[model samples]
Target chain A: MSIDDKNVILEIDGLQTYFYSSEGVAKAVDGASFSLSKGKVLGVVGESGCGKSVTAQSVMRLVPSPPGKIVGGRIMFDGKDLTKLSMAEMRHVRGDRISMIFQEPMTSLNPVFTIGDQLSEMFMLHRGMSRKDALDASVEMLARVQIPAPRARAREYPHQLSGGMRQRAMIAMALSCEPEILIADEPTTALDVTVQAQILDLIIKLKEDFGTAVEMITHDLGVIAETADSVVVMYAGRVVEQADTVELFENTLHPYTRGLLDSTPILGRRTAGKFEKLNEIKGMVPSLYSLPKGCKFQERCPKAMPICSEREPQLTEINDSHAVRCWLHIPH
Target chain B: MGPRERPQFTTMASYILRRVLQGLLVLLAVSFVCFCLFRYTGDPVLMLAGKYATQEEREMVRHAYGLDQPTHIQYIKFLGGALKGEFGKSYVSQVDALDTILERFPATFELALVAILISFAVGVGMGIVVSIWPKGCVSRILMSGSLLGISIPTFLTGILLVMLCSVYLEILPAFGRGDTVQLGPWRTGLLTLDGLKHIILPALTLSSYQLAVMMRLTRAGMREVMGEEYIKTAWAKGLSPAKVILKHALRNVLIPVVTIAGLSFGELIAFSIVTETIFQWPGMGNLLLTSIFETDQPIIVTYIMLTSCIILFINILVDLLYAVLNPKIRYN
Candidate 1:
């Protein structure tokens, strides 16, 4: 398919990211497939170690060698297969065409540099802006992110700023060159609820303004609900379900997605005239090193059937804009 | 970002002053201890007197050199002389002790400077390369080599190098700072081809410890730092590996490496005692060894005091460097 003909900016098909250690290989991301359209946000929702972060790193080509390797994948971004690009070529695509924000705002910034220095680095490195021009642009970007005393804030180091402020600065740095794709790996996870909302709002607003496609990786379902246009539910490095956000939330299909939705506490309305105890998905997430033969979540799946252990399910389209990997959904 | 507050200049000045005062106190304590210890080590009068001297002759020598004075009075006199940069005169040579130490200092300085420069360059370079491909064949080999470097003592390494390079091959001199060969009208006292050749073995021997220390610290620090969220963010920003690792990851790793290096500077000076003796280089280390055997009380005392002062100065420099390297550090 000619990807350029469509609005899809990023497309990952049959992506497999693995970690090879002395003991064994960990299939961190196995056969994951998804596409992000222009100006849309694709939320990759998963528990820790589910390979959402690895998927993001794979796209960025940032995975460390030996221990972590992208053995198989086709990561198409801006009319090029990123996995096939040379290190030098890949560099051109990074920061300029695709930029990423990280989970821990507290530590994501280089502590030794002023926020201004870090922000200006992007403009200077990719855009080839002069030092003064980059500095001016950095201040402008900080102001755009709603930072007060922009010029002064730019001069302050990352440690000097509050967590929320640092995340805002991080966003400013990420969006400095107006990248076509922005990969935010739990950008607000380190912030509190209030700050989380603010960060989420800021990201959404900035995405709207810049028209940048976003791959938002988060464990928090609430964050996905707030910012994601489409959702890819992952478990044990595999995509369990993929759907439009509203449809996925309204008609939660995959057992893992249902478990995630059930566990989150809603703002209002009591069920059966009483506040119900929060639901939790039974059992822990499976280890990536030795995932189960059939469904990775079979042991923890509340609706597991005999057939689940017998055969692994493939992600099959169930309806328009909705797909799920489950034996229950298959017609006998 | 909001209402930025820079660290006030007065606070920085006061902090520097406090550190200087503390350093002075430390120096005073160190000097006092060394003075008291050396006073009881041997009798200067006996060494000054001839083997068949009469009681009157010994007494006269004692009175002349203030050896007959109380310990407190002698200490006060010593302190007064030290303050004026005069350690009176060497007990054996009867020449100015300060001038004697200063003359040999240039040779030692040249050797030490070259050793440290080589150590930093090689160590940091190896560290960055090793960190990038920690488990690769080259990195693993380097890691093991660094381990071996750390395990061997400086003297042993010196001897081995001398045997292999000088004794076995005769490619380079095994000992001495080489015969005089002037480079230019303006000489650094070390800007000579012979000087360079003479310094190689001693400098290499001296740097082995520093190289091992810096390489290990840098590798460990780089490993930890390279895995950080900021590094990944930098890569995602589409920065080249060189840019991401060198520009972003390097600064964070340098904190620990620089700390170890700064602290090791004094150790290097102390270690030169052995390195210089092995090579027979005309440096302070040799002067110190000869003075000890000759019962030159003034030279010994002056060298100890000078070393203490250098250490204190380094500590202050390190503190200032910390403020520069890590903006999180405020002097107050």
Candidate 2:
């Protein structure tokens, strides 16, 4: 639990982001805890509604209101408690120290502005660079992202670019300021398989060059396996398991994590002489409003025990750098 | 041949010519409809010669105004006169109809320009404020106030403003364009300080609905844009919320807003009939209303043609603006 020993760039402790609506308070992120080390990629993998994106938005203080809010959390970034900072103060930290890329490249960019204008604005606003210098930097950043004809591309708008190009332009803008930490929320989800791989490779390559830590949020375990140094598996707005990527994949813990790994369609993994159906986690995801009494995954878990239905389990450390939230992992 | 190639001058020239031709076609159709409608509405001779006039006098009056001809022939003549800027004499004034309309054009333009400016400034400003802190009490008040602006009719608002600001308070002039003041050798006519006082009530009245509409569209657009991934990316880049909203959110929102504002400009010019009549302002709207009452065929036809031409021109300007505001758009 003491992830502070490492050169941690971002440490989130017991973060609780909630959505309060007429229906009820839905704990979108209920007591989630994780740490991202410097110059490393940490993948937070989960199902669609598992609060992975919410956790990332909370870090940026970009949660929508009237329904969504970061009710409780301590997001420590570069020795500053983001939750404690005023909006004005937080603005300094956003896009400067901790930048983010988004899921839908097609829509993430401001369609009205040229890519150069959007990218250069980051430098002008935060770095206080002159328009000429900012634009030059933008073109440079575009080139660094491996864009063909970076100068011309910068002058173009988001819609004019291909999907892959737009996402790269987004990356170019995010990385323009050379941020300390980059949070990419499902950055490749809306792209084709080929484009997705290219974007992922680009991210990993850029992370190396910039030495910026990354929090990669995705439902695809394959992406996590490919890009993550460490991994956090979430279920129902809480971290069900957390471990180094290799360890998490090799020795999968938590029924939800196991279910996710099993569901992945790995090449050449079918049983010999028999056609095997894809494994599906049974039962619908519990609605945020009316979750069950005990373990959230208990109803859908094949190995559910009486204790799972009776009480929720804490995220217990099972080994060095490995944690799981399950009665099975709890010491007697 | 590439997407970023600067378009050839010939291409732009051809595009503009095509647009102009299309606009002329639209104007022709509109003129045809207005000619038929006004001709069939009532007897111009009845209004021109009076009900007690002799049959010969009525016939002479009809022939004098060129209204004795068939509708199609009259339309051809009207189109010919409009093309040459010779809109015949007014039925009541005995002055050239084009001259009368030209005299009123500046006043209407001045009022419409100021009103549109006010609407843009207040609407966009309030929209940004409301959208930024959408759940705050201030935002709620502004949104509710905008709804009130939209709900109230312009004439009612005009009367209320006049009552409060002019009649009761004596702060501003009650009606009419104020007395013209000459500075040096040049007379500003309606732009003088005294003239501005007369404008406040009518301008506010003219822009009430537009102001509300701009605010609502901007607010809705901002609210939607704020949820976009690029906005989240903007914050994550360490941009202050103000910068994110202004530089990132506002630019994107302006696309739809500009469309509304541009289209509404035409509406404001045409619909000022009610506001002008209420205030007794010597604008084109007032002239049109009086001309209609007198069954002034030449003035009425010219006014309709002028308004439609202005609307068509504005539509073309809006289309060109799309390319400037959003680089994705291209005329070619």
Candidate 3:
């Protein structure tokens, strides 16, 4: 599906990554396709292991091997195919052209070094600045991310700071270079709700201030609602639906997307309950390896049809910047 | 701490003082055990003179060394004298124990310092490289080699080095702590200085075991840290692998790595016992071993105290480092 003709900074076509494990070949990103434009937060939402994070990692070429391998894909960044870059070339592109903030805050910053050292080191190595220049830039970056007492905190090691502070430091490091694209892979998963909101806001402001495009990978539909301009709903290693955020919420055609939205615990919306519990999809996500022949997610699709079980439903455009891959949504 | 609080300088000084005091108590307890254990083994004169000492002469020697005093009085006197820079006299050397130890200390220091430096630079560097550069033939070979190094005994490894390097290379010394061809008091014990005139073989003998251990522990620590989310995040941010491994991975890996490195230093002291005996190096290890053989109770006791004191000092330093490396750690 063509996602509105904008300045597509990143476009992935039929990206497939498989893992060779004892169990079987796990297709982590099986023929996943999408495009992300500049200054946009394209939220790719999915459950854990549904290939949302893998999609992001693959774009950055961060997927671990043996069990995970990018067997097929074209990651078009600017004019170059990122997948074809040499190891040395990829290293330069990784933090300079593209930056990724990870899920766990505590695990995303080195515990031994002071926050300042990490941030400054980035400047020193990438920007090739003097130590003093690196330090000044680091302090500025820290302040930009709204860290308390940037100078003092810079000298403080990771363990000395609280969880939220570490996440901010991570963002500061990621944004320090002002890469064109910032890939945040569930960056707030480990944070408390309040801190989560603050971090999200910080990211939005940073992106706006720096004019950086964002490919935000997350499992939370609520977070997507607040931040994403567009949303790609992934199921069983494939994009089930893609649309403008408002359109996706207003007219979600895919059964899986419907289930996810329906399941969100909404307060004051249910008749008898204090909070309306989300309706869980009937069955679990299928194993990536040894999946069903045609539709990997057909087993749990509410509107599953015989055609869906035998032939995978391709994502067909239903409206401007909107698409759905479901037999029910298929036009006769 | 308020501005009115103890000046920062005073606080640091007080902290150091407390640490020293703690070291003293530990030294006392350790010295008592060494005194009791060494004395209980057998009389000093019989071991020293080897059935050559007349009864009166043996008594005279014992009296001179203060061995005739009660155990408690000897301990108090020994502890007091040790605190005041007096390590008592070595009956065999017929010189101040401090002087005799000082004479050998340089050689041992040189051997250990070189070995450890080699271990740290090679082991830690290789570990970080292997972790970041995994999935290659060289990385695999390095990792497996590290595992093998850690599993094998240092002496056996030392022997292997001697066989291959000494017997094969025919350049480095295969065995011997150092040669007796001394240049001056400074070069008395070490191979490089006193015997570099004959140094290579013995230095190799001293360092061989450490190479394996250092490589192995560093690999293990770096590998584990590389797996951490922070390291992955650093890599994703487009930081070069070197920066990621050294700054992000190495820093976090170090507490454990340093622990391993420091513990190896302690192990070096013990391992030197065998290496020193094998090579006949005139270091603390050989001296201690010979004193034990001669049943030189006072000197042996003194030797044990010295080793324990070194260990105690190392432990304190490690604790201080913990505070610096990890802010979560509180000395209070």
TM-score for the A-chain in each candidate structure: 0.96, 0.97, 0.96
Deviation from truth (RMSD, Å), model 3: 4.0
Alpha carbon lDDT of each predicted model: 0.86, 0.85, 0.77
Candidate order, lDDT descending: 1, 2, 3
Local accuracy of candidate 3 as per-residue lDDT tens digits, A1-332 = 44555689899989998878888788888889999988889999988889998888898888886567889979998789988988788878877778989888887787666788888877876799999899999999999999878998887777767888999999999988888999998988899888999999999999999989999998899999999999999988899999999999999899899999988877667766555456898888877766897777788877778887788889889987799888788864
Q: Give each prediction's root-mean-square deviation over alpha carbons.
A: 3.4, 3.4, 4.0
Ten contiguous residues with the weakest lDDT in model 1 chain B: B180-189
Against the true structure, whose lDDT is highest?
1
Tell me which of candidates 2 and 3 scores higher on TM-score. Answer: 2
Q: B211-255 in candidate 1: lDDT tens per residue?
A: 977888888888888778777777777677677788888888888
User: Residue A169 in model 1: shift from native, Å?
Assistant: 1.5
Question: What are the TM values for chain B, all candidates?
Answer: 0.92, 0.88, 0.78
Give the C-alpha miss distance for residue A187 in model 3, angstroms.
2.6
